[model samples]
Target: MPHLHDDALTLLALGEAPTDEESAHLDLCPRCRADLGSFRRVVTAARQAGAEEPGTAAAADSDNPGLQSPGPDVWARIHRELNLDDALRNDPLASPNAFAADAFDPARPSPAAHAGTPQGNVRPLAAARHRRTGAWLAAAAAAVVVAGAGTWATLRAVDPVPGPEVVASAELSPLPAYSDTGSAVVDRLPDGRRELVVTSTGDDAQGYREVWLLAPDATSMVSLGTMEGTEAHFELPADLDLSRYPVVDVSDEPYDGDPAHSGDSILRGELDL
Candidate 1:
């Protein structure tokens, strides 16, 4: 059997009893069951957040403050920022007609016109309920969009923009026996922090790879870090002078716990700063 539609699931979440076929499908299909559960959770959360208890309408109205509508400027800003259509510039919660302008018609016959008929009273109530539900949903969706846009703007204002400058770069060539060739770049970030990005491609050696910064004379060196794949980023110490350690080297190291350069350099290059 086909899965239930989203509308059916939403109606179920809104407390409408499921039909026998729907119940049977829900019992058999795990995916539909999970979807229904998710919709139900959202409905429950919304109700808990905004719904007042039954029989407490008068007391609640007297004691608790009602939700305030956002200012016109809020909707205007949301419209400008989100580039929404001009038709949606108006706040949906400000008026019921905002979403369902034609929901009610003065020319249409009223339920009283067909008072003697069986469906006269029921039809009007059902239609009214449907319109109210649809209008509420539309307003709720618009409110969510506005809130999300506001949140995005707030986050964009607070988050820092990354500006990386390549202070030095090197073209890593295969040393002698190894066929791996790659490149390395030292980037200076906006916050005065430095990092080395390396990328290489070749046959996978038996041992793991290690990165290092070496002196021009190949006498002194410092291990930046280990490389697990073809690309990696290693943070450079603030105190480490790049001029003194201008050579970048990638080596294949064995599992031996020597903590020293294996001297088996796969690729090496001198940075041009």
Candidate 2:
């Protein structure tokens, strides 16, 4: 059966459940229902994050789907979209994970630390210290806002939510016992789309990177498109079964289109689904 992907579930979650005729087909098809459930979970999760106040649910239900309504803040939506609620709720970085310019090494002293102060006078030193502290505080505050806003905008544009998006990933062979670098991370967006950020070194003499999707059993493999860069970002198919194929492998491929194994595998890693 053709995959009844998340886009269809999106339509249903928007209160446009399939008509009687289509609903019968969906009820009879397990795969379609499973796909729909995943999308609905994502939408429901997104809404739950935004409905901070007790009455928001009622309000959301009453709002017309066609009308222009003030939706959740972009960051809030992203957290929900990406199923990052648990992570964000427990994380130091709540929504957007972007770093602001002033957020680096706040405790590190700068050479120009006292540049704004006058010489020799105790009051000047004290005043300058206060000013410096204040400046740092202001910068820190701005960084927080920027980080939050930036994460929202980035996730919004990238649509980090998981969906039937096209994904590009590479293998990271020989993963450390517990290494973060050997993993590919795909962020979920507020709209239920996903953004796959895959990393691999491409210094091999071979010019192409072979990417594969390892079946859950780890017995079979499916080919994702090949890549050439050290870092590549791709949108994964929305209907991808995260529970099934949880690993991605990146290998070095020659310039031929042959489907046989190259036997020159370089990288193999798992996705932190």
Q: Which candidate wins on TM-score?
A: 1
Q: After superposition, which runs of candidate 1 have C-alpha atoms over 4 Å from their true positions?
A: 1-160
TM-score of each: 0.42, 0.36
- Residue 87's lDDT within candidate 1 is 39
CA-only RMSD, every prediction: 18.4, 19.4
lDDT of 2: 0.46
Candidate 2 on 1-273: residue-level lDDT in tens?
Answer: 344434344455534446564587574443455456555665555444434322232233445343222233543554355453231322223333221222222333333445653333224221222233322232222223233233444222322145443232223555333222333555565577775655644445354666666775668776677666666656668887765777777666777877855755566666544
Residue pairs with clashing backbones, model 1: none
- 160-233: candidate 1 lDDT, tens digit per residue: 23346657777788988878877787877669899898878764766889999999999999999899788889
lDDT to native, each model: 0.64, 0.46
Candidate 2 regions off by >4 Å?
1-171, 175-182, 205-207
TM-score of 2: 0.36
